[model samples]
Target: MKRAAELELALAPRAEGVTLQRWLCGELRAAILAGRLAPGCRLPSTRDFARQQAISRGTVVAVYDQLIAEGYLSGATGSGTTVAAALPIAAAGTAQPRTSAAPGIARAAAADTAGTDDAATKRPRLSRQGQLLANSPFLSREGMVLGRPFSPNQPDLGAFPHALWQRLTHQQGRGLRPDDMGYGDGAGHQPLRRAIAEHLRYSQRIDCHAGQVMILSSAQQALDLCARLLLDPGDTALVEDPGYPGAARLFELGGARVQGVPVDRLGLCTDALPTAEEARLAYVTAAHQSPLGGTLPLERRLALLAWAEAGRRIIIEDDYDGEYRFDGAPLPALKSLDRHDRVIYLGTFSKLLFPALRLAYAVVPEWLAEPFASAISLTVRHAPILPQAVLAAFIGEGHFARHLRQMRRLYGERAACFQHECATQLDGLLTVLPITTGLDATALLPRGSDDRAVAAALGAWGVEARPISFYGMGQPAPPGLVMGFSACNEAAIRRGVATMAPVLESFNAAAAGNRGQAVAGV
Candidate 1:
């Protein structure tokens, strides 16, 4: 009957990408909790379970090993894997542990299971905008968990200079004044601002002084601040279709009417932008469009500036992946071409370093600098001074530049290798899009399909590819997957693609079969 239960587990809604291992893990755990698999119950041997389920032995072994690690199962020499003899699940209304259980482990299990009861408590009311942001499917649920392979926009964290960073952080900490430890300027640490200004002026070709730079936690923070300060409750904001969701969400939260302007291969369609007097703020990633990886041409950039100047409108240029373009000379930041001081340049160290760094900056015009600084003060006051100081030193010395140079090369190589694998292994299965910038690239399905489900299936296969539809706020979006190469090594990319090939091939076969059956009936 247990063998029958294992086979039954295999049949449950697996089309949602419930892998054999995951289903078994969930089922076995549920059984143990419900007392179906009693304490000390012997689980089937890996070989036997795999035979019953018609799945690979490795999956069963993996499930067994994970359960052992999590204390839901136990294994010992000569003793087969067994349900943990004393699970820490409490009775309906009690917290007392079973007397026969291992000490400490029972309490740990009880606490883990207790979270469900806590969650079942009543929820609080949220504001209208808060509800919109929360219920939006585009919003990310990934919080604090380590990123998986092939996740988009992820940097090669393994390449970070940890020892040097630790040294810099300690050195900065040891020298902080009482003022530094206490509340500080919202604009930023003056030294870090000066360093950033100098770096941008010389490297990014953005001419600005330290006074014009306002430091924030991330580019998302910068976007939210700008929207709050600039847009009224009902002002219209122009954003790129298939653009970064965080920007659109922040603008919506500010009670602004967001219009998704269409984009093409060359990036945001400037001609399609609302006429000069209609909108106030335009959020554009000119260096590299978020999902599509297109660089707005110099002509288009000039036109955008002219449009902004004519209307006295503001442009927020998010140069997130500008430094990672694998093709052609890197173009100057949009701020570099600003003659009317209408562009607010936003940059972040998250991509350059790691996400945990929590440091980003915005370059405002001289007239708005004071107002921007005041707003930042009211918001989060300032980023944690310690990391800011460490980053400032990292840039002040040549380490930052050297790291960027090395990362550019490493990402370039990884991109090339992944592209090569796609060409050789997935030529007919997926129409790989041309990639020039960003940590991830796009690939189209041969036909319109449920990319969301496909993306979920790919995730189950240990691959990461965001559904193209996930990036769209407007209707009639394209169907594809945004596959990332930066977080993984060449071998992982290769292995992930290999795992994907059969799934895609099976879909193609089924689609063909359906068409054939239709034609025969017709």
Candidate 2:
């Protein structure tokens, strides 16, 4: 008969100030590595584990996440967690001694072999400066640390229906059949595709059938698939000057020669499109332009569509945050008006649901749908089935619409509070760039001020705001900080900005001192 033992006894002593969650994770990891726990062995339930370890259930969950991320365990919906099938092992045998040959011949052979090995192992060199900058873009760095982020593109996570999601997830598990656990449809869950089609029709006035919507991992993937389908190595693609970096990077990486088209208040100047040669694709965020946050006027939209038809170019419209319009009624997506079948519309649930969900869809023109679907299937097979299923259920059950309504109210209040605070506190010190729609909130800093330095100082106070310069295509941009008000509450907004005021003042004083020094030196 096999014997069962108490794994809890193997735990190490807890260090002072270390979280119980961390300690439990460390103990569980050690027990697994020591082989006290074997592959296929089930973990105790969260409640049972917490009782056994004399810790909270939350602590157990954190430990489980750590183990899962480390590849030590696997988790299923109804089934309890179990150990992974295999663990990495180091070779046990010692190295064999080399036999001697003629010194010159051995040296020559060794050099040749080493040269070949080095060549094989060589990786694409990432530029050091580029890597450093890329690690955290100006927007990401500032937004992550600033006390009250005033940048756009932030979502109100607190208002998300976590309890409802948990309940739905449990319900899904209870009703899911055995076959549902296997690989799903390559395009996406059929129900999800249908649900999205209905959603686009009702919400965005899009005229797409479920078959036209192809699920992708993200808008980035959508862009990648589009680039692959439309662009060749030497092909030219037009990108907005101040656009989403995610789209710009994807196009460049696909070997398309990218040209930046300037944006005025009307958004992506169609007349400014380089006429030197015909381009294969033009990428635009017409609904709510990135960084500048201007909605493309209807006339300009028609002009862009006309331009695309004239040049036989495909227009990639990224309507990333289309649902969050605060002023007037939401406009129809560009794809809705593409009678010529020249526009490929990209939309994402990332902003609406959460960034971690990694669920997005692309509406391909009738002519391109087959090719795009084929490319997606060949590349990633499809987006994961579970998220699609959950989202479909969420939408079908009307939870999605309800959630959006709730979030819209919350975000509107927060935005109002942020704008009021900015006007009252900063006054002439900053210029609040008008954002009448969507989730973007931008404010230009004093001219000649180091926006990067100001953002860093705000980070010291625990407020995260993105710098506008990070969004520029080429050359330095105007001094400004892009603040996202969606995630914070009125109190947090007030506190964060109140904390940031002194930092800005101090920065301004330092700048004046530096200028005085420069003038004296001259």
Candidate 3:
């Protein structure tokens, strides 16, 4: 009866494209690899298997014969149809335990009663990597959302020179050679790399040749590649507390143990870093820290450099929004101060040009250039070529620099206005954090406050805000909200907050009343 039940399960179909025989083979193979079937276990007789599955006896015989031939099953003189005890995959790998969590399982068991809604269905089973992506808190799920106040990771899309960009894209498309339209160099097009190298040298005071640059679709991609190449499963990686959640998720998915180091007004505390050569890589946003917006100070930067040099460790310096500094000339990038060649510096056009551009670059040590290129080749193979060409032209023609100059002045004004509004309207509830640079600033909430609920309320009222606690990976987090001022004008900021302050006030009053009632009962 158990054998019959197992046969029925193993032959049941999923998604209708493949032939029945092919699906049977796949199901059996996956069961073996996932360890649902143990080595030396006997499969049902071909006639019995056919009877249970309601398939042809010949079909069952062919599947068993194929499994025997491929070493998935055994047909030795004494063994009738036993699972192979020494399968090749089992020679090098072991099975996952049944106790593992099932994150994305299936819909059939619930189909009849639960209807067609996804939440009503059984969750599909996900692999270890897919499980991490499935549970990510930082990634936005909204598609085609209309722009609103205080959106996270937003840039001033309205200020972009759309007509000029369209013209440049059209111009580049016209000039593409037959070869240019095909898959490009995975390391990126030569002209764009050269353009980026020059742009970094002049703008961020970092030195690198075009050969040292690897272009990717986004900074998040760069983070994934570094995690894959530099660290192995269970390898330790140090990340900033309240760091970019996208990076934390990638590192975890890559099977790295990400340790969170606390960040202060200056930046990541170098003293808190591992003392005795432990972490394989450290990810930092030195130019403009993501949510908190603290530039790592010079002395701390020096200490971090020394720490990396001492352990021969690698540091990923994400300068995603480094260009729009309103304070005195921006501090020299961490890459500029590195004497040991251990820093991989990242920059993105998404914040500068626009997010839809999906272009970012990393300047790496000479030793990693070829290996990094090969990795990119094996993964995405190459970023789409036309956009790379257009951006190279845009930077070469001086339009990118001119745009930066304009955004710097504009964002500084918008940020000041945001601060003013938050102070006057939500002063007792939320305090605006220091804002020297970056596209957004944070508003710290009262201790123990629920920032996610507040952010949801703001969203319901047509404002898009991110809960500040979402960024921290481990340890207790202070309550706050990350507010993007670059994307919205002063009028929008004031108007949104005007509506927001009253809602927050009423929520606070109700919460106070509940606490008072509880105290009186006690």
Which is the leading candidate under TM-score? 3
Candidate 1 ranges beyond 4 A from true positions: 1-124, 136-147, 517-522
* Candidate 3 residue-wise lDDT, 2-37, digit = tens: 652265454344445656666666667656765667
Off-target runs (Cα >4 Å) in candidate 2 are: 1-152, 513-522
lDDT of 1 by residue, 305-389 (tens): 9889888899999998787777754678999999899999999988878988889999999999999999998988788888888
Best-first order by lDDT: 3, 1, 2
* Backbone clash pairs in model 3 (N, Cα, C under 3 Å; residues 3+ apart or in different chains), count: 6
Of 1 and 3, which scores higher on lDDT? 3
Candidate 2, residue 248: lDDT: 69
The sequence of per-residue lDDT tens digits that candidate 2 reaches over residues 1-522 is 332223344455676766777666655655565455677777777877788778888878887887899788888998878777676520111111121322233343345445465534553466743563365433453336322455456677666889988888888778788898887666788899899999899888999899888888899889878877888877889888776676666666667788888886557887787655548889999888887777898888998888888888899999988687776557888888899989989989878888778899988888887888778879888788777888899999999988777777777777788889988998767787776666668788888987878877777777666677767787346788887888777888888778878888887788789999999999
TM-score of each predicted structure versus truth? 0.75, 0.73, 0.76
lDDT of 3: 0.81
lDDT of 1: 0.81
Q: Tell me the whole-model lDDT of each prediction, alpha carbons only.
A: 0.81, 0.76, 0.81
